[model samples]
Target: MRFLLIEDHEDLGRSVQERLMLEGHAVDLAQTLAQAREFQQAAVYDLVLLDIMLPDGDGRVFLTSQREAGNTTPVIVMTARAAISDRVGTLDMGADDYITKPFDYAELEARCRAILRRRGGVADTRHRHADLTFDPLAGTIEVNGETRELRSRELRLLEVFLGAPGRILSKDHLCDRLFSFSEPVSDNAIEVYVGRLRKKLAGSRLRIDTMRGLGYRLSGT
Candidate 1:
């Protein structure tokens, strides 16, 4: 999943970004409300980890603006505000969940998964395409009863294709989804990852089809 992490604290933000990336999720870190808005406008995110107290302004207000603008992207607010009213206020302003500061990383990860599951209507973390089974959480792919580990990039690539089976995804769109805003990536880099993923899925029922001008699509034979 792609996530937008809006945080100001250097250490916490870096920790969260690294943790999420290690879990095979692409994350873009924004330090202030302005930066967060720019990132949010540039791409669609599966979820957002927002810190209520930002350098530029209150995160709740930014969330409120997002809601008012009809952006239904799920937001999980992280703040030191432990008061019940504070929590309620964030929820009322359209935060999908709230986590107080100094919380466990495990709890945050769990909440992210829960919210994504509910939104995606996917109870299980495993995604399937024909005879191929992909466990996003485990970062493994199984085909014909044989399981193999996937590199982080390969796993993310497969997730993108699996999410929209049989649909053509433009190179630009795929690049945006696979690489974070901060990462330097070229169209050729996307091709390299796609080639690697195709090689990995060799002999499987699922195939990646390249369209002349449209881009690529995942198809099952």
Candidate 2:
């Protein structure tokens, strides 16, 4: 999953980014509210880890703006303040969850996953169809109970398929979703990953159908 970490502290932001990366998540770090706003406008994210105190502006303002814009991206407010009123205010302002400052990195990761899982409407990380099983967190594919790990890019492609099963996804859209603003990924690269995934799931009922000019789909029928 993709995440946006909005923090002003350089050290804390870097640490959180590294930890989330180790957990198999793609994260973008924004050290200021301006940077965060820019990133939010350009890219889509599964979750946003926001620090309530910013050098430029209050994180609460950013949250309010996002909500006003009808952005439903789940946000977890992180703050040094532990006052009851602050917590209540953040929640009332539309935060999906909250974490206090000097927090544990593990707890932050867990909270992010919990929010995403709830929003995904699936309690488990596994998404299954027919005989094919996909674990987004582990980046593993199981066919007939035989499991194999996937490369990062291939796993990302599989994620898109699992999330929108039976629906066609254009290669262009897939490229935009799987890659970040910094990386340059091509159409052939996407095809390569898709080809690799097909071989990995060769024995399963899962099939990625190519619709010529349209793109690809995980065909159920």
Candidate 3:
């Protein structure tokens, strides 16, 4: 999944970015609201980790703007505020979840996964399509009863496919979801990932179909 992290604190921002990156997700870090807006305009994020206090303004302002503009990207507000009102107020502003500062990485990651699982409308990280079983939390995919680990990008690609099953996904949309803004990408990056995934899905009933000039779709062959 791709993420937009809006934070001003240097150490915390880097720490969180590194942690999320290590987990095989692409993340873009913005230290100010302006940069955050720029990143938002440039890329589509599956999730946004927002900080309450920013250099330009409070995080609530950004969240309010996103909701008013009909941007439904999930947001998780990170705040150091201890007051219950502050926590409740963020939720009222359309935050999907919130984590208090001074939090452990494990707890924060858990919250992120929980939100994503809910966003994908799946009860858990485990999903199966015919004989192909995917458990992202476990970092393993079972194809025709054979289990193996896939690369990070491959796993992420499966996550997107699993979320929408047979829906057509455009290359532009796939590119946005699969890479960070800073990552250098080739014109055929999505195709490369799709090709790799196709090889992995061999012997399974599912296949990725390329629609001419449209996009790609995961469907049973």
Using all chains and alpha carbons, the TM-scores for the candidates as numbered come to: 0.91, 0.85, 0.87
Question: What lDDT score is found at residue 72 in candidate 1?
Answer: 95
Top of the candidates by TM-score: 1
Ranked candidates (lDDT, high to low): 3, 1, 2
120 in model 3: Cα distance from truth in Å? 2.5
Give the per-residue lDDT digits (tens) of candidate 2, residues 1-221. 78889998999998998788666566888989999889977878988999987999999999998999999999999999999999999999999999998999989988987887799888788987788888877778888879999887678777778778789899877766666554566659778888998898788888898889998998762
* lDDT of every model, 2 decimals: 0.89, 0.84, 0.89
Overall local distance difference test of candidate 1: 0.89
lDDT of 2 at 211: 84
Locate the minimum summed-lDDT window of 10 residues in model 2: 178-187
Pick the lDDT winner. 3
lDDT of 3 by residue, 65-117 (tens): 99999999999999999789998989998999989998999998999999988
User: Candidate 3, 157: how far from true, in Å?
Assistant: 1.1
Candidate 3 regions exceeding 4 Å error are: 164-171, 186-188, 210-216
**Residue 110, model 3: Cα distance from true site in angstroms:** 0.8
RMSD for all candidates, in order, please: 1.9, 2.5, 2.3
